[model samples]
Target: MIETIVFDVGETLTRDDCYWNLWADWLGIPRHTLSALVGAVVAQGLDNAEALRLVRPGIDLAAEYHAREAAGRGECLDESDLYDDVHPGLSALQQLGVRVVIAGNQTGRVGELLRGLDLPADVIVTSAEWGVAKPQPEFFHRVLEVAQAAPDETLYVGDHPANDIFPAKAAGLRAAHIRRGPWGHLWADAPEVVAAADWRIDSLTQLVDVVRA
Candidate 1:
């Protein structure tokens, strides 16, 4: 039985719609153009960051992020940023006495943002806080420690097949691919990636049923 359900942050628990627009504006590119560029990057099976570099040379992502953060322009997930299914699903898990955690590759400020938002997760962890990120064995191990959960008893849910499902399975946890975000829809038709996940869900509501079942 799954005792702990760990979730990815961006595009999983959160919508992440604000990011593309923000980055596009910063790159001086039209939002739709940037969207197509991102789609092309995924189509070519290239890393998103590397593709961004190819699209706009000399773009320092970290520097840009820091500049925005310092200027009080950093993005935060508001109540409206969550998917319609997120709250109900999380709340259902809470009521079931299941341990819910938000563990994903995110900046240090992510924990603070989630805390402020008061999401339903019992334990919230970010890549920055753990000094490691997903697709890394160490990161999942850390999550296991915090959750006091065995690998087989944990379910890792995220939108990215490469960074989420594959790694979680490799770490001996059951993995669910949520097919609504960028990575999800991008890799939706990829048989190998789809096969790697133990479950494929289109909505967060499906997860409540998964755990309960």
Candidate 2:
């Protein structure tokens, strides 16, 4: 039985529309343009930051991010940014004694933002906090360490296959490919995702039955 459930942030737990829209406003670009580039990079399996580079060649993203913060425009989130099913799904799991963890590749400010939401998760952390990003073995290693459960008994759920499914499987954790968001729905039936994911689900609510079964 799955004793612990670890979730990915973008698309899996929270919709990233606001997050990226803020970026669009920050970079003075059309939202659709950046959104399109994001899709293009994901389709090509390029790092997500590549999308920004594609838009503004030679742009220093880290510096720009700090500048945006200094301008009082940085990463932000709220209940509205979350999917409708996040609370129902996680709360049900918590009631069932399943440990729920929210970890993802997000800025440290996002870590604070998520904590502010007060989601029903035992632990909420981010890549920025750990200084390691997803698709890195050490990241999953730390996930397993925090889970306090055997890798096989812990499930890592996310929308990105290369970053979430493949890496979680490689780390011996069961992986669930969530079919929402651009990455999720687009890659839902991709050969590699279909082959690698231990489970492919469309709704966070479905996780209840997943844990029970």
Candidate 3:
């Protein structure tokens, strides 16, 4: 039985409009354009960051990130930014004595943002803090270490098949393909992605029963 449930942040627990819109402003592009970029990137099976590079050459991502942080942007999010299912789902898991962890590919500032919102997570970690990002095996290993739980006892849920499901399973943790976000809904029919998951969920609320099972 799974004793811990690890979740991805963007598009899993939180909607990314705030973060992406900030990037849109920084890039001097209309928000709708950035939205199109995202859809194109996902449809082409390209990495989101790489898609940005393809669109704008010589863009210094680190410098832009620092500039944004220094200028007090993308630092906090409103409660409306989260999916409706997030709070109840996380609450249900906690009430079952299941450890709920947020381990996702995000910048160092994610911890601060989550704390500012006081999200319901037993532990929160990010790729920046771990010095690695998914779909790296080290990232998942670190999550398991942080949770003090074995891979077999962990259920990893995320919307991205490549970054979340594949890596978690490769690292020996059970993966749940949540079909609610860009990559999730777009690639739901992909044979390999479908095969990689141990479970599939339509929403976070579904996870309450899955974890209990």
Candidate 4:
């Protein structure tokens, strides 16, 4: 039985494509250029912080990204973007006796986002705060520890196969892929990437059934 569910924030739970669009707008560059820039940074093999520093000079990339989102939408970037029925879904999960946690590369803002939405998860595991990135067994193991869940009893859902599915499966958790529209298209040619997931769903609402089953 699945006693716990862990979710990835960006792309998976949140509207990351919208966020990326805001970033592109703020940078006054084409969206694909920004995408390519990220690809270039990764191609050079820089760590997250180093890659951000090298590519987005003179800026805290995460902060700037949030600022752009807030400005463009005229609202604070809250965790509501993570799910449409944020409170309802969480309440339903809690009522069903399932513990929910969030595991992601948060760069320090996810806690604030969750707080703003008033959706305090059972636990939060972040790469920026944890000093480890997903796809690494250590990161998922940390979340498993905090959730007090046996790997087999937990389910991990995320959009990125490499960052989400692969490590979660390797760590012994069941994995699910949440396909985030345009952003998911970026991996269209890579079927092998998502092969690690035990199941795949297009929306967060669909997770309820997967967990209940």
Q: What is the TM-score of each candidate against the true structure?
A: 0.94, 0.97, 0.94, 0.73
- Global CA lDDT computed for model 1: 0.84
State the local distance difference test value for candidate 4: 0.69
TM-score of 4: 0.73
Error of 4 at 114 (Å): 2.0
Candidate with best TM-score: 2
Give the residue spans of candidate 4 off by over 4 A: 30-76, 181-194
Model 2, poorest ten-residue lDDT window?
A: 42-51
> What tens-digit string does per-residue lDDT give for candidate 4 at 1-213?
889888787766666555555556666778877666656644453332343454467877657766755775422356546657556666677778889887787765555655556564677656877888777788988888876788888998877766777788888899887666333445533577556778777766676787778
Please state the error at residue 158 of candidate 4 in Å. Answer: 0.3
Error of 2 at 107 (Å): 1.2
Between candidates 1 and 3, the lDDT winner: 3
Which lDDT tens digits does candidate 3 get at residues 1-213?
888999998888888888778888877888888888888998998887765675578889888788888887745567888999888889888998999899899877776677677777899888998899998888988989977788999999999988999889989999898887678899987899878899888888887778666
User: lDDT by residue for model 1 over 10-35, one digit each (tens)?
Assistant: 88988766777777776777888877
Candidate closer to the true structure by TM-score (higher is better), 3 or 4: 3
lDDT winner between 1 and 4, please give it: 1
Deviating ranges (above 4 Å) for candidate 1:
none
* Cα error, candidate 2, residue 8 (Å): 0.4
Candidate 3 global TM-score = 0.94
Candidate 3 pairs with clashing backbones: none
RMSD of each: 1.5, 0.9, 1.4, 4.9
Which order, best to worst by lDDT?
Answer: 2, 3, 1, 4
Off by over 4 Å in 3: none
